[model samples]
Target: MATPLSAERLLTALRDEGLTVHEYREWRTHNRNAKGPWGPVHGVMVHHTVTSGTEASVRLCYEGHSTLPGPLCHGVIDKAGEVHLVGHGRANHAGGGDGDVLAAVIAERELPPDNDADTDGNPHFYGFECVNLGDGQDPWPAAQLLAVERAAAALCRAHGWNHRSVIGHLEWQPGKIDPRGFTMDAMRDRVRKRLGVPPDGGGGAPEFEPFPGAAFFAPGRSSPIVTAMGHRLVAEDCGRYQVGPGPEWTSVDQESYAAWQRKLGFTGDDADGIPGETSWTRLKVPKS
Candidate 1:
């Protein structure tokens, strides 16, 4: 499909959405060629500058930090909800995430785990970094969350994607926190509701499953037991993984489970690859 809107067109569209627009001095060229199809854009990734002022956040994203190089995102949303376009094509945000999740977003299916930055996310996702502390203590101003929701909704509408396409920086990165305070799931929930998708993980009945204390896992249609287990782990601070307790499990989950094998001391490799048994034993779970 053709590009939804040119930078100029996007600026106009954003303005129509009631957001103030600012064009950064050092942004990606509007006509720059992209690596892949701009259509089928699965979703939008929300981020926090983790910096104080909008100017500083803009400069950092435009110039990039020492660790990330430069041009870290496509747009920067300020405290007042003004959106500043930084880069257009492949703006360097979105490292690796689970391919399954990417596909699910594209298909408008329920999302799975975001495993790695292995794929070229920049080509497929529009990135936005909002100016906020993301320290969890910093309350998400009503304006900021509104801006995020609007921005995400606009992008999803343009791309024909549902709110499930919306996610957070923390959701993509393991051992890293971002856009804190508000949960990624919660943010997506608002988006989903707005888009008219069933907020309860789509039309599929939620499966309750146990998640091993692993680095990541993805749940699919199955017993609510497995779904409940995975949900518990995510709630208790487990990274998102795209393994359904039934099948399509990856080696990573196995590694994650084996690493914590000793946590289930008496258990054997039974917990090594499965998302149950020993791995579940290691988890400090609350009664449901």
Candidate 2:
């Protein structure tokens, strides 16, 4: 059993794991804590939205159906690997689940078949509703699957839990078959491997470098990674220089990246010739 991480910490953890997160309106405050307890958390629960269209699915997860109330899950992982945070505590996603399953998760052991619904899982698990049709044929894109693995791994790393701490909705509850088209055990293996690779290149807890936010591109700061970003900018046909987007950052590189941002339709301060997080991520600059 573990205390729930604060909302701010959860966001930081996910980002540190290299997952793209988008905070929805009032997401920090959105939760089902008024109805029940939110902690003594044991694990992370993964689910499928049975829905298409990221925006609609995210909204639905944030605002549940009339019978169920709202704050269905903590986050909605979309097809493009973007995680839209919807709620923070005691979400409605995981209902009554098997006590045996909870025991297994807590022990970090192999899960037994979920044959009973005797435990309150909402208070025990962090939920992530991934967008999918649940039709079996709907594809799970590589990026989306990576997001799922990273999201789950980030939580497990935080709690010092192993792969067994991650489970699918179907694995936790009876009469529920969400998160189809992929095996939970396989996903856990992926999470396990991620946990082995330290974020800072040290064999310990992750110490990720900050994401290249807009502030990272402010004048006077220099990094060799700037050259990689310049190459990506040139490839995208946004280059605006006489020559050399060399190993150093220059006004030309900033202007070119800003033009790329404009091509992507950002305006005003957002497009003020600076590299913001979203645009920088979309650019996918290679590691230096």
Candidate 3:
């Protein structure tokens, strides 16, 4: 329902959301705009490149293979969580998709099942091709996943759209299953939380709450900081709490924090739920 963002705006939005972006060769001027319309964008579309390694994938996307043409997508999200801009307006990604799904996306509501493909998504969506095996076995490292979230959130925020505006290629195409390792729903939840940003662009209205150290989370603790954290966890769809994330430090808080840790790609003892300085810093909890 809006015009496409300028290349400058695209870069600014992404950087504003805290992503490390790499400008590929001729990315600013590269596009398939000559082939069709490329405005009135409705949302963002996600995909997997079904390839391994960053440099090759980015190159392939920038210079697409035979039968697909070149500049296959606007950006290639590498496994390292770096966003490599390959092309600008109207890249070759987001081929035809379900019209019903497109309508739902325009309405910013729950998407209908994509059983038909009578729509040209190329003109209406911004495509991101993420490097992966698409085999479900390839790991989605925490950094990579977080980059996807930030990248998508950046666009949605700029457009004033919500998490609903982001959709997986699988959700748009019939018999397609890209972005396989993580559920779109979960990813949307992460985007929603990150998008909870106010005019200040998150980190609270002014700044994020400081990490209070592990000792501060001892049982029976009561503070608004704990409550703010709980809300953030819930927004991330990681709430393992039985009820309220009240101002008390209950096991519920630990369980929820663990879920967040796991979502960030931590595992085993590292995902043990307790907050570490590194993870805490990344969480960016709003000041109480």
Candidate 4:
């Protein structure tokens, strides 16, 4: 069992981990503690907002709908890698979840599937709502994902817990998947690495494919990789397609790639629209 960190300590821990944190209005005092207990904390829970635009998402999370009440989460991690502190204690993020899952988190052991929702997760977990559409195609920028890893690792470090103490919303609830673009296991690997622990020891290494190279985007290529790249391009707001960045590469893809190149300050022949090793690597497009 772990005790909840004070607001000051939590803020300090996040900052010490190199996160860009923004304190919202009355965030230190905002919470739903009246609804339930907020002690004996177990772990950190990560979730996606399933919304867009940093400002709007932050507001929505800070001030939830009437049905849900405000302070939907303790923090809102924006696309730019900034953490907006919306509330401190007992935020309305994690709902009922499997007690067994919570037990696994406390033990720093591998989790069983969350088949039941009989536990009060809101009181036991610190929650972060990351900005994302939650659709598999929404695209998780590397910065945002890194922020997630750092934030979770920060909490785990403070609590003297391992990466197994971190879990996605999908891992807790019966049928919910807010973070769809990336796998929780891979995220855990990152946190484990940050914690100086071998990533494949307890739960084994995640099987996510490595990022494909620029050659994978060559003309006549019609794999799901192209579609994944297009999704990433669209997420970066560099897509130039009027119809589709479909499986096959077209002039539009070249045009879009050129725009991305220009965005990265490439000029002359360098901005000829084809993906290069550098730009493609920077994009960090998720492997299909």
Candidate 5:
């Protein structure tokens, strides 16, 4: 088995991975955490450009969008999955989120719901921005997906964290959505699978102890599920925890479940699993 990649070692690996590397001194820091460990990092966060090409996305990540001053992420991964380091140490990526979620992620505990963007995730997460349209229709090439998996798995190996720690940008923010079609849960699954971890035994997303309303919980029924799912799935290393069968729940009748859920309008979280609305819906189904 290979060793995990640290932030410093990650640089060498990216260089070795055949990607042009650039260091932005204008966006570097030491990240003083009064309440956390300074090493053995937790996990990786994946995102989509929502911009067009690789170069453009890279420039945007370094330059930042109008809403966010600049230096939006730590790295920009191209459509080919080649990583380009942008900023390091507290880059302006993950904003506010559930503190329990962050704590669980750091401890590698089962994730909890990210009800709001109230925490500073950038301080803890290693962000990666991949080139994609973010339109939910962009085709995720195997090469790009593989690159993401490699990068994430390498980090997991380094930090002693399972692939479950990895998440997506959309999962962190409330009204924001990037890294669309490729759900965080799906991404984590690939990373774990690559690391020789059995898909089932690995951690699942944190439980939303007190689930929201029926409409809020049901797939296609509310917007919160996607955001909520993104939060839980990434921490648990599952894909968006949507209501029915989807890419996230591969152990079950995946194809049929996804088909049914999509028809109901749930893109990420509103699908099935154990308890809660998704489970209720699935439980209601007649056993084959």
Candidate 6:
């Protein structure tokens, strides 16, 4: 267990990670600690605001919605990679999630599927909301993505945690997916590479699936491949998904693939939704 990073220390840690942080209104004194306990933090939780535009997203995160209270998260990471500090202790992010996932985070091990929701996560995790449309096609710019990695890495470093200690909201709660464009696994890899440390016995290295060939994506079946391709589409700003890049193929997949082909300067029949070897290789589908 780790004590929550002090606001001062938090700022220092982020800066040490080479980030530009902006202190929002009354951030030092803003919190919801009076409503609950805010200690024994185990890890950082990453989220994406379904809203776009940095200023509005930051303000909304700071002032919250009618259903949720203000200071929705500890920080709002914008498209430029700048971090806007909103709250310190006990932000409103990370609601009830799988207790098993929390346990895995504490133990620094591979996480189990988050199928249950018996745990209230608001009190134990520091949360950061990335500015995005969360529509899978909104595009997570390199700057914003790096800021998230740094933010999570900063907290992990301060708490003596390895990359395993970081998690996405999707990894915690059931039926919730704020972050759509990137994989938490990829983000954790970013943290690992950034931190340049051992895995802290979090288990063996993860296996990445190489491109199985363009023929493998012919649909008629559900698998992690479709989801992986979808992630790559979103990353390349060719995403067309409104829901999940889930295991099964849908029109979203075709549309997203076609968009990617077009972006790559493919035209006419060459821009057909079906992926070719050249485009498939470029997608870099998480090595899978």
The root-mean-square deviation over C-alpha atoms between each candidate and the true structure, in angstroms, is 16.6, 13.2, 15.6, 16.7, 17.5, 18.8
lDDT of each: 0.61, 0.82, 0.84, 0.83, 0.58, 0.83
Best by lDDT, which number?
Answer: 3
**Once all C-alphas are superposed, what RMSD does model 2 give against the true structure?**
13.2
* lDDT for each residue of candidate 5 in 1-288, tens digit (9 for 90 to 100): 112233455564455434455665544442323434333345677777778887778778887867774467777777776777776555566767666777776665556666776776756777787888988888888878878887776566433457678877666666667778767777877876665565565473322324443444333343433433332232222333334323232333333434445544566666443234554342222111
Q: Which stretches of candidate 6 lie over 4 Å from their true place?
A: 199-288
Off by over 4 Å in 5: 1-7, 15-40, 201-288
Q: What ranges in model 4 sit over 4 Å off? A: 203-288
- Our tally of clashes for model 5 stands at 23
Q: After TM-score superposition, what is the CA distance of residue 67 in candidate 4 from its true location, in Å?
A: 0.7
Taking the tens digit of each residue's C-alpha lDDT, what string does model 2 give over 56-149? Answer: 9999999999899779899999999999999988899999999999998888778899999999999999999999999999999999999999
lDDT of 4 by residue, 40-129 (tens): 788899999989999999999999997999899999999989999999888889999999999898878899999999998999999999
For candidate 3, the 10 contiguous residues with the lowest summed lDDT are: 197-206
lDDT tens readout by residue for model 3, 1-288: 665777866886788689999999999999888999987899899999999999999999999988987688888898889999999888888898999999888887788899998999999998999999999999998999999999998887656567788999999999899889999988987887787644322222224778899899998899998987875676455777666768999898999999989878999999988899888876667665
> Could you give candidate 1's per-residue lDDT for residues 58-161 as a string of tens digits?
88888886677557888888878788888766666777666776777666566666666556666667789988887767667788787788788666544445
Q: How many clashes in candidate 2? A: 0
Clashes of each: 25, 0, 0, 1, 23, 2
Mark the 10 consecutive residues where model 6 has the least summed lDDT. 200-209
Clashing pairs in 4: 258-273
TM-score of each: 0.62, 0.69, 0.69, 0.70, 0.59, 0.69
Off by over 4 Å in 2: 197-288
Arranged by lDDT, best first? 3, 6, 4, 2, 1, 5
